[model samples]
Target chain A: MEISELKITIVGLGLIGGSFSMALRELKPKKLWAVDINQDVLKMAETQGIIDRGFLKPNIPLKNSDVVIISLYPEQTVNFIKNNLNNFKRGAVITDTTGIKDKILTEINNFIRDDLEFIGGHPMAGKEAMGFEFASAEIFKGANYILTPTDKNKEENIKLIEKIVMGIGCKNLIKISPKKHDEIIAYTSQMPHILALALVNSNHIDGLGLFVGDSFRAITRVANINARLWAELLIKNKDNILGQIKSFEDSLINIKKSVMEMDSDGLRRIFEKGSDMRDILWRL
Target chain B: MEISELKITIVGLGLIGGSFSMALRELKPKKLWAVDINQDVLKMAETQGIIDRGFLKPNIPLKNSDVVIISLYPEQTVNFIKNNLNNFKRGAVITDTTGIKDKILTEINNFIRDDLEFIGGHPMAGKEAMGFEFASAEIFKGANYILTPTDKNKEENIKLIEKIVMGIGCKNLIKISPKKHDEIIAYTSQMPHILALALVNSNHIDGLGLFVGDSFRAITRVANINARLWAELLIKNKDNILGQIKSFEDSLINIKKSVMEMDSDGLRRIFEKGSDMRDILWRL
Candidate 1:
C-alpha cells in the first residue's frame, strides 16, 4: 500500500511516540492516531494537529490501523502487544521502538498470530528530556534507524517501514539480526549511559561547578537520564551490558596502572590508540 | 600598574599561548610579545598582528616584560622558569597555563626569585585539537579561570591577574590553594579524560559505526586527545587521579551489580541520584 493511503497508529505519546507522530505527519498518512494513557497528552497532540485523533485505549485504533508503531517501555511494550493481540486488523504490519530486541522478539513470537507481521525497530536518537510536551520531529532527522527482521516479516512490509523511516529524514537504515542488535546496542548505547551515570555519582570536592571544563560537561550530558525507562532497558540487556562493562573496566585499569607507575610511554601509547580509534570511527 | 601600561610576554605559542595572545590583544597592553622555539609560529603571530613582536628565544622578552604567561607542558614550564630565573624584570607578575599545579608550583617555588612574583593560574578551557593554528581568543570566552596564590604573591599582583582574566572574557575567577586545585582537577578534568579514552578503547561488535548514538558520541568526544600533554597531566596528578578513579569504579560496580541482580528498584534509585546530581551541578 502507498504511504499516503495507509492508516497509522502510534502507541504511547511520550518523547519517541510523539516524535514519530510529528515526523509521520509530514508524510500525510490517510489517518494518524495516537493511543496514550494520559488523556491530557492526547488532548495536546490533537489540539496541535499532530494527529488526526487520539485514543485513551488501544482497542479502537488497533482494530483500524493498517500499521501500528508501539513506542513504550520494554516490558510495557510486550504486555501491550499481548493484551491487544485480538484487536489488530488482519495482516497488519506492527513494529516497536524498544531498546532491547532479542527477548522482546522471542516473547512476541510465541503468541503472535500467523497473519500479522511484527518488525523490531530502534531509532538511535533522543534527548535527555521526557514526555509528549518535549518531543520534536527534528530528533529523527539524520538519525540511524535499525530494523531487525526475522522470518516472520514480509519483504513488502519491511519496504513500507523503510519508506516511513526515510520520510522522517533518517539518513541510515541498518538491517541486522535481533541478537546482533542487542549486542551492539549494549556497547554503543547502554554502556555509555551507565558510564555517564557513574561519572556523575562519583565523589568530588566541594564547589565542583567552579572547576568543570568542556570535557566534564560533554561526558556528563546524558547523566540526567530517564531513570524508569533506562532501568528497564539496562536490566533487560544485562548480560551484554555486563560484558561491555567488563571490557571497559579492563581498559580503564590498564590506563590507571600506567598512571600509578608513572609510565609515561605506556600512558602515551594508550592515549594514542584511543585517539586513532576515535578518528577512525568518526571518519567512517 | 594598569593593564594598558604593562609589557606582557607569553611563552610557548601553542593553543593556550596563541589564544592568550589573541584575548590579551583586546586589552591593548603597552607591548604584546610572544616567545617560542618555533620561529614559524612566531612569524605567523606577528604577521597576523596578534602579537606586537615574537621571539625565537625567551631571553630578550623575559628581561623586559612586566608580566609573562607561560603556556607550555607542565615540566617544560618548570624548566623554563628555573632556567630564566635571573631574566625576568623585578616585581614582574608571572603565571602559567599548566593543567596540574601542586608539583609545578613547588618546583618553581624552590628557585623563584622573591623579587619576582609567580602566581599559578589555569584557564579551565580547551579543545581536543592542539597547536597554535587552532587557537582562538573565543576559547576563553565565558570560561572559568583558576588562580592559585600563595603568601609569596602580593595582593596587588593577584588583583592584576584577575583584571587580565576578566579582560580575556572569563566569566568566573576561582581562587584556591595549589593543593586544592590539583585535588579538584583530578575529578573534574583528568578522570573524565581517562574515562573517555577507556570507553573508546573498550571492546565492541564489528561495524560499530552503524550503532553510534549521541550518548556514545558525547562520552567519547575527548577520546581524540593530546596524548603527550594528557599523559604528563595524568601522571603529575597521579595520587589524586587514582583516588578519583577508585571512587568512580565503586559507583560503576554498584550500578553494575544492580543490573546483574535484576534489582529494578535499586537501579532506578541510583539513576535518580545521578540525575539529581547532574541537574544540581549544572544549575549551580
Candidate 2:
C-alpha cells in the first residue's frame, strides 16, 4: 500500500510518539491519529495540526488504523498491546519505539494475532528532556532505526515500515534479530547511561563549575537523565547490562592499576589503543 | 603597564600557545613574538600576522619581552624555565599553561628568581587534536581560565594576567591556590578523561558504529586523546586521581548491585541523586 493511503495511529504522545507524529505528518498519510492518556497532550497535538484526530482511548483508533506505532515505556507497551490485542484493525502492521526488543517480542509472540504483523523497532534518537512539549520532528533526521522482524512478519509489511522509517528522515535502517538488538543496545546505550549516572554521583567536591572543561561537560551531558525510565531499562536488560558493566569495570581497573603503579608505558599503551579504536569507529 | 604597550613573547607555539598568540593579537601589543622548535609553525604564525617576529631560540625574545607565556608539556615547561632562568628580562611577568600546578609550582619555587614574577595559569580549554596546525583563537571563547597565584606573585602581575585572560575571550578568571587547583582538577578534568579512555577501551564489540547514539558519542568524545600527554598528566597527579577513581568505583558498584538484584527502588534513588545533582551543577 502507498504511504499516503494508510491510516496511521501513534499510541502515546510523549517525546517519541509526538516526534513520530510530527515527522510522519510530512509523509501526508491519509489520516494521522494519536491515542494518548493525557487529554491535554492530545489537544495540543491536534491544535498543532500534526494529527488528523486524537483519541483518549485506544479502542476506536486501534480498530480504524492501518498502522500503529506504540511509543510507551517497556512495561506499559506490553500491557497496552496485551489489553487491546482485539482492538487493532485486521491485518494492520504494528511497530514500536521501545528501547529493548527481545523480551517484548517474546511476550508478544505468544499471543499475537496471526493476521497482524508486529515489527519491533528502536529509533536511536532522543534528548535528555521528556514530554510532548519538547518533541521535535528533526530528532530523527540523522538517527538510526533498528527493526527486529520475525518470521511472522511478511516481507511487504517490513518494506512498508522501512518506507516510514525513511520517511521520518532516519539515516540508517538496521535489521537485526531481537536478541542482537538487546545485546548491542546494552553496550551502546544502557551501559553508557549507567556510567554517566555513576560519574555524576561520584562528585564530592563543591563549586566544580570553575574547574570543568568541555570533557567534563560532554561526559556528563546524559547524567541529567530520566530516573524512572532508566531504572526500568537497566533492570529489564539486567543480564546484558551487567555483562557490559563488568567489562567496563575490568577496563577501569586495568587503567587504575597502571596509574597507581606509575606505569607510564602501560598507561600510554592503553590510551593509544583507545585512541586508535575510537578513531576507527568514528571514521567508519 | 597597558596591554597595548607591553612587549609579549609566547614560548612553545603548540595548540595553546598558537591560540594564545592569535587571541592576543587583537590587543595590538607593542610587539608579539613566538618561539618554537618547529620552524614551520613559527613561519605560519608570522605569515598569518599573528606575531611580529618568530624565534627559533627563546633567548632573544625572552630577554626583550616584558610579558612571557610558556605553553609546553609539564616537564618541558619546568625545564625551559630552569634552563633560561637568566634569559628573561628584568621584572618580566612569566606565566605558564600547564594542567597541574602544585608540582610545577613547587619545583619552580626551589629555583625561581625573585626579580621576576611567575604566576601559574591553566586555561581549561583543549581539543583531542594537538599542535599549532589545529589551533584557533576561538578555543578560549567562553572557556574557564584558572590562575594559581602565590605570595610571590605581585598583585599587579596577577591583575595584568587577568586582563589578558579576559581579553583572550575566557568567560571566567578563577584565582585559586596551586594545591586547591590540582585537587579540584583531579575530580573535574583528569577523572573524566580517564573515564572516557576506559569507556572506549571497554568496547569489545566489532561494529558499534551502527549501534551508538548521542549519549555514547558524548561520553567517549575525549577517548581520541593525546596518549603521551594524558599519561604524564594522569601519573603526575596520581594520588588525587586514584582517590577519584576509587570513589567512582564505589558509585558504579552500588548501581551495579541494584541492577543485579532487580531493586527498582534502589536504582531509582541512585539515578535520581545523579540526575538532581547534574541539574544543580549545570544550572549553577
Candidate 3:
C-alpha cells in the first residue's frame, strides 16, 4: 500500500515518535496524526511539522487510522492500546517502539481487540542524546528493524509493517519470535546498559572529575541512565535481563580470577576475546 | 628556552612518541632523536622528517639527550630506565607516557640517579588502534596532559618539563601526586577497560553475531582491549584498580536495586546525570 493511503497515528511524540513521524513523512503519508499527552510538546512538534494533524490528549476517540504506533513505555503502551482498541479501524495494523516484547506481547494478547492486528517492531538505533531537538530523520538509516510476530499475527499485516519501516530508511528488517527478541535484547542492549550504568554509579566520577580520561568517560558514559523507565523494563523482563546480568557478572569474575592469580596471560586472553568479538561484530 | 635550544630523544616512535616529535619539530628543536624496536617503523618516521636523527634500537647513549621521554608499557618503562640510567647526562629530565603511575613511581624511585628527575606525563587520548600505522601528530591536541611529580622532583626541572609538554599540543596540563593520579585512573581508564573486556568477552560475538545495535557495539568498542598491556597494567596497579572495580560493583548494585524495585525515577536520574556529565565533559 502507498503512504497516501495510510492514515498513521503516532502516540507519544517524544524523541522516537517525533523522529519516526519525520522519517515516515518522506513516504508522503496523507495524514500523520499524533496523540501526545503533553499539548506543549505536541504543539512544538506541530510547529516543526513533525506531524500534520495532532491531538493534545487521549480524551477524544482515535480516528479510523490505518496504523497506530505507540511510542510509550512498555507498560504504558498496554494501557494505551486497551483504551484505544475500540476507536481504531477494524483492520488497522498496531505496533509499538517499546524496548521489551514479553510483557507487551502478553498484555496485547490479553486485551487487544480481535479486529486489530499488532505486529511488534523495534528499530535498533538511538543516540547518547535524546529528544526532538537532536532527533534526526536519518537515525534509522541502514539500521536493523526487527519485525516480531506470533501465530496470531497476519502475514499481510507483518509484511505491510515491514514495508512501512523500510520507508523510514531502515535497510534491514528481520523476522523473529517475540520471546527470542526479548532474550537477545537482554544480552545485547539491557546487559550492556546495566554494566555501563553500574560502572558509572560505582566509580568516583562526581568528586574526581578532572582525572577522568576521554576513554573512561566514553566507556561508562551510558551509566547516567534513565532509571525509572529502565527499572520497569528490567523487572518486566526479569528472566531475560537477570540472566544477561548474571552473564556479565560471570565475565567480571573471570577477570577477577585472573587478576587475583597474577595471571596476565588469562587477563590478556579475556581482553583479546573482547577485542576480537568487538571486531567481528563490527565486521557485519 | 625556545624549542631550537632544546635537545630531545624519544624512545618509542608510536602514536604518543611520534606526536611528541612532530610537536617538538614545530618548535624547531636543535636535535630530535628517536629509537624504536621496529626499524620499519623508524623508516616510516624518517619519512615524516620530524627527527633530525633516528635510530633503530639506538646504541648511542640516551644520556647525551637533554630530555628523555620513554613511551612504552608500565613494566618495560622500568626496564628501559634500568638498562640506561647510568648513561644519562646529569640533570636530564626523564619522563614517560604510562597510564598508571603508582606502581611506576614506587618501582623506580629509589634506584634512579639523584641527578635524573623522573617527571611522568600521561596524555589521555588513543584510538582503538595501536602503533605507528594509525598514529597522528595531532591526537594530543586539546587533550589532557598530566604531569605527575613526586616531592623529590626539582622545581626547575618541573617547569622545564611543563614548558616542553605545553610546547607540544597538550595545553591542559594538570599536576597531581602519582598516587592520586593512579587512584583516579583506576575509576577512569583502567576500570573502564576491564568492564569493556568483560562485556566483550561475555557476549561471545563469534557465536551470536546478528543481534547487536550500534549502541551496544559503540559502548563496548573499547572491549577490543590491548590485553597484554592492560593485564600487566591492571595487576601493577592492582590495589587501586581493585578499588575501582569495587566502586563499579557498588554502582551496579544501586542500579540493580532500582530495577528490582521497578524504580523508573531512580533510573532517569542516573541517565540525567550521565547526560549532564557527558555534555559538560565533552565541552572540556
Candidate 4:
C-alpha cells in the first residue's frame, strides 16, 4: 500500500500514543484514527487536529484500519487486543507500545486472529514524567525500538510494522525475541530506576540543598518518576528485575567490602573498571 | 585587613586552586601570590596574569600574606598546612579547600600557631573533567561554600573567610561542624558516586547503544569519574561511606524483596516515597 493510503489507528492517547500519532501524521495517512478512554484527551486530540477522528470506545471505522498500534499500559494492552481482536480488519498488522513484552506477547498470540498478526514493540525511550501533556514527537527521535516477533508472526506483517516504526523516526530497529528483550531491559532500564529510587528514599533529602552538586542531581534526576506507571512496569517484569537486582547487589557488596576494609587498590580497580565500561558510550 | 590592601597566597594550582586564583583576581589584592610545587604551573599562572607573583616554593613573602588558601587533594591539603604552618604570617586567617575535613581539621588544630587561625572550607562544586585548563571562575557562582570551624576557631577569623568566600561569588556560606559535614557528605556526595560506579560496573556496557536511554545517561553521567581522586576520597571517608552504603542497601533490599514477591502495592509505596523526597530538590 502507498504510505498516504494507509489507515492507521493508535489506541490510548497518552505520551507514547499521542507522540506516535503526531509522528505517524508525517506519513500523511488516509485516515488517522485515535481511541482514548478519557473524553478530555479525545476531545483535545480531535480539536487540535491530532487525528481525523477520536473514539471513547472502539467503533466500526477502527475495524477498517490497515495498521493498529495499541499504546495502553502493559496489562490493559493485552486485554484490549484480546477483547477487540475480531474488530480489527483481516490481515491488519497489529503492534503495541508497552515496556514489558513476555506476558503481553504470549496472551495476545494465544487468542489473536490467525489472519491478523500481533507484533510486540517497545520504544526504548520515555520521559521521567508521564501523561500526554508532556508528549512530543521528538521524544522518539534517535531512540531504539525493539520488535519481538514470535514464530507465529507473518513475514509481511512484520515488514509492515517495521515500516511504521521507521516512519515514526526510530533510529534503530532491533529484532529480538520477547524473552531476550525482557532480560536486556531488566539490566539497562529497570535496574537504573530501582537504583535512583533507592538512592532518594535512603537519604533524608530535607537538607539536600546544602549538600547536593551536579553528581547528586544527575543520579537522582530519574527519581522525579512516574510512580504509578513504573510500579506497574516493575510488577510486570518481576523475575528479570529480581535477577538484575541480584547481579547489581553483588557488585555493590563487593565495592562496599573494599571500602570497609580500606583497600584503596581494590576500590581503584572497581572505579577504573566502571570508568572503562562507561567510556564505551563515548567511543560509540 | 582591607580587602584590596591584603596580600593573598594560594597554594597548589589544580582545578580548585586555579579557579580560586582567577576568582580572587576580582578582589584586586595588593599581591595575589601563587605557590605551586610545579614550576611550569606557577609560570603558566603568572603568564596568564591570574596571579601578581608566582612562587615555586614557600617564600618569606608568603609570611607577610594576610590570607592564605590551600587548595589540594584531601591528604595533600593536610600535609601542606602541617609543613607550612610556620610559613603563614602571624595572625593570618588560613583556610583549605578539600572535600573530607575531620582529619585535616584535627591535624591543623592540634599543632597550630596561637596567632594564626585555621578554618576548614569546602566549595561544594566541581566538574568531572579535571585540569587547570578546565577551571573557571564561574564554577563557584551559585555553589555552596561550607565552612567547618572548630571551637578553636576565632569568630573574627571565620568572618574573614566568609568575606573571601563571598568575594569569590559563592552563593551561600553554611557553617557546619566537621563531623556533621562528613556524615552529610557521605549520603549526599559519596553515596551517589558509589551508586554511579556500581551501576556502571554492574552491567555489560559494551553494547550500551542498543539499550541506553536518557535515564541511563543521567544516572551514569558521573561515571566519567576521576578514578584516582575518587579512590582517595572513598578511602579517606571510609567509615561514613560504609554507613551510607548500609542504609542505601537496606532500601534496595526492601525494593528487591517487593519486586521478587510481585507486591505492587509495596513497590508503589517505595516509589511514591522516593518521588516525594526527590521533589524537595525542585521546591528548593
Cα deviation in Å at residue B34, candidate 1? 2.7
Q: Per-prediction TM-score, please? A: 0.96, 0.94, 0.91, 0.96
Sort order, lDDT high to low: 1, 2, 4, 3
Q: Kindly indicate the candidate among 1 and 4 with the higher lDDT.
A: 1
Of all native A–B interface contacts, model 4 reproduces a fraction of 0.76
lDDT assessment of candidate 1: 0.91
Q: Give the top-scoring candidate (lDDT).
A: 1
Candidate 4 residue pairs that clash:
none
Residue A278's C-alpha lDDT in candidate 2?
A: 72
The residue-by-residue lDDT of candidate 2 on A61-154, one tens digit each, is: 8998999999999889888888999999999999999898998899988888888888999999998799999999999998899999998889
C-alpha RMSD for every candidate: 1.8, 2.2, 2.8, 1.8
Clash totals for all models, in order?
0, 0, 16, 0
Clashing pairs in 2: none
Docking class of 1: medium
